[model samples]
Target: MASEFELIARHFTPVVSGSRTGVCLGVGDDCALLTPRAGQRLAISVDTSVVNVHFPADAPPEAIGHRALAVSLSDLAAMGAEARWCLMALAIADADDDWLASFARGFHELCAATGTTLVGGDVTRGELAIGVTVMGEVPSGQALTRDGARPGDVLAVTGALGAGAGGLALWQRGERDMAHPLLMRYLRPQPRLEAGRGLLDLASAAIDVSDGLLADLGHVLKASGVGARMEVDSVPMAAGLVEALGPDAARRAALGGGDDYELLVSLPPDAMDEAVRRLASQGLALTPIGRVTADPGLAGVGEIGPHGWQHFHGGAS
Candidate 1:
């Protein structure tokens, strides 16, 4: 059996950036140190996933690693921050070297792609679980928030919705086809980092759709002290969702399904064209879903039954 120190050294230590610049000390140190860029505000968020709760116990180790970090990074994206550093805490049932190495590969691959550094973290023996604390920075006074939305602003989403939830449905049905788009969506979600940064100058308010489009949109409306009227027909849905789940069920999933991780934004009507163009230049598309209104709550979408995801809505199923 490998000791804790040996496990970390073999699997995680190599992923730490030795770049001696922004990070003073990385993994192997008692505590990681960092220096934020001058004139910028640090944005931080923590997220955790537990086996059989957030993911199936039988899920591939690589997907678990990718999902844990991707969920945390989505928060930084919602704030229009550039992801910089992340610390992970893992609890595993056993010292499975192969599983550990594969997980590290997935985590490090994302860090490399995003230019984020692995700072420091801990490992413990327990049921399978992963938690990550991510840090990013945005120009002072420029980070977008849910409160910045206002009446007459147009509501838009970075990409199609319901993919993650649809993926989960397929996975739960015992379908293990890794090549299926919905399954891939559920297993490995891509956080919208670049799209988030692009919105820093244009979006009045933004949030990532981890919970469901209508549910998460309700959050922006509540914070901004406004209401919304969605053009339900215009809501962008995941590819092949309608064909798989039928139009009504697919629409329902698109509206209330969780785990999409796509950005839902509200911006001025006059700026819509420019925002769309800017996002398009980066190979991303922004679809207009609705408009903010002076009323108090979600309108068209809310009238439909069963909105958004909640952790403990009922007794254990």
Candidate 2:
């Protein structure tokens, strides 16, 4: 087996060795040194995905790698920050060289696309999990937070809801082709970084829809000290969602199935049109599903049971 250093050097180091931008020091050091743009505040978040729990044990390495960075980057998106650098800590039972190469390919492709440089991380032997820490920047005092939502603010979401959950359902039903839109949505989540950043000045508050839409929006309402009423019909479904899962199941998935990395935001009712227009200009969709109400709990979509996935609660997203 190759030594840990050998593994990192072979698979990870070369990606960082050339063309240092905001990164002053790359993979060779104990800690990566990164520089943020002037007059900016740092936004950092970390996420870990475990085998079987977060994803199937036999899923492709590329998907796994893409997912690790994508989810962490989603956090930055929710805050309307610009992604700069990422660190990946990989724990595996064996040092499979081929797996490392493929995984690096996926991870680096995303980094390149998003202009994020990889700086530092670790490789260790363990139960097979990946942890990604993403660092981003936002103009001082301009960072979007969940607390800014007001009681009258209109609640909106980017893209479709339930695609992640719908994709997971398809996979559970033995669909493995990554080409399927649902599967790609589930396996290779595209963080809404562009939309998030564009909506920064417009959105009063924002949070990523990692958990179910209801659950995640519940968080925003809680933080903002507001309540909300959701129009279930206003919630947009993915293109193929209804046909694939049937109406009832699709409704359930859309309502509470989680794993959707779309951004949920609250803005003044007047700002809603601008937000929607901005997203459309960027070739993305923004939908108004509800309005902030008092306190927290489902209102417009009445008679709904418990929803969303929370770790350690035995719920799957």
Candidate 3:
């Protein structure tokens, strides 16, 4: 039998298949080869998860695997790109066969579900870290960017918010039983891939809500060089989040808590109805939460709370 490192290099590294449009030489090479289609652009993103930083060291292998990929895939969704391939790098503290198997199963399952393949990566022994580099493709000029929002464009979100933050709170408080669905939502977030695809032609600007709504939207604002006015009452909240965390707490979490992985988009006012209808046709909902404004300040309409996740303000677990 081969050593653990050799086993991974031999079997796992070469597990993925090649793509006709994107890949020229996939695996078993000193360097992978890629060639983009004539009118297509390749979108690439990398996400990292450390044992204690991102998740508990003892966190379920499958959940860790799922989250590792899901977070990276979320970036693809943000760009309105179609997921194509991924490269996974693992740093394990120990060589546990069971853990590795479970993680691989979880990761591969998600890859298949999203029509993406594991193209290449490396495995090393270290302090239990995982990094996934995802590649996606979109039409050369059709890819959505944060810089496209204009004044009067409607600010919208693809799905509910606050549930993951609420679930995290419950988990930290040892009230796991109480959170129920919220807890699951925190552990296994679904990337809004279909919503992203639907918004490709509709949204003027787009981003995924990984760092809470306000912060993520701020990214769009910065990129687009515009300001926004968000309607507090229009922001969608998950069912039972307010009941569980109380109205104030729920509002804060929904606005500022990170890791929701929902799609945030800006669409022209005239296109809102058609955009919503297109998403609806794909069994997704686009909730209009606010509008782009000429004023270049972070302002909100009604009472939308403090406006999304902050890194140093204490929310990460």
Candidate 4:
């Protein structure tokens, strides 16, 4: 078996941006040296995925790598930050060269696509797991937060919802076809970075949909000390989701499902047209799901029970 350092060098080292795009020093160092851009605030988040917990044990290595980093970046997107660097810690059962290479490729591919660099991380022997610490930067004073939402702001979401949950639902049914759109959604989720960046200074509050839509939206309401009214028909469903899960179940999936990774934002009513136009230019949809209200608690979307993934309780996210 190859030494631990050997695996790191072979799989991860080469992917670091020698160009130093906000990185002063990358791998092979005790601590990753980083430098934020002038007049910008650092936005950081960490996400951990465990086998049979976050994902199935038999999931593709490539998907595992992509999903881990993507989840953390989703947090950066929620803050309207540009993803810059990431550190990945992997705990694997054994030194499987092929799996490592494939995982690395998936991780590196996303890094390249998102302009993120692999700065530092670790590899160890244990049950299959991945922990990604992602860092990004946003202009000072322009970072969006959950507390900024006001009663009159319009609640919106980027792209569709329920796809991840729909995919997971399909996957849990013993479906192994990786190519299925729903399954791919569960495996590979695209973080809405561009839509988020464009919403800077426009969105009053923002959060990524990781836990189910309603569950995460409730988070925003709590932080902002406001309430919201969801337009049930306006909540976008994932392609073919209704056909697969039926209208009622699909509605529940969009409302109460988790792992979508889409940005749920509260934007000023005046900013709605611009926000819609900007995202539409990029071929991404920004739909109004509801409007923030002065009262506390959620209204509309009748009786959509128990949404999102809860780790302690084993719920879908």
lDDT leader: 4
Tell me the lDDT of model 3 at 92: 76
lDDT of 4 by residue, 126-172 (tens): 89889999999999999989899998899999888888778878888
Q: Model 2 TM-score? A: 0.94
Per-residue lDDT of candidate 3, residues 1-317 (tens digit): 24667645543553543565356777677666776666788899999888767766655677788888998999999888999888888887666577777777778788878987776787777888889999988898999889999999999998788876877777777764533877767767787777887888888999998778888888899888999888877889877789879998898778877778889999998889998898889777789999999888677644543442474225332
How do all models score by TM-score?
0.94, 0.94, 0.90, 0.94
lDDT tens per residue, model 1, 1-317 = 35754875678886444443378778877898887788999999998888887888888888888888998999999999999999999888775678778788888888887778888898887898889999999999999899999999999998888887788778888989888888888788889989999999999999998877877888898899999988989988899788778897788778877788899999999989999999899888899998999997777765574343443121121
In terms of lDDT, the poorest run of 10 residues in model 4 is 305-314
Per candidate, the number of residue pairs that clash is: 0, 3, 3, 6
Looking at model 1, the pairs that clash are: none
The alpha-carbon lDDT assigned to residue 239 of candidate 1 equals: 91
Q: Score each candidate by Cα lDDT.
A: 0.84, 0.84, 0.79, 0.85
Q: What alpha-carbon RMSD in Å does predicted model 4 have with respect to the real structure?
A: 2.1
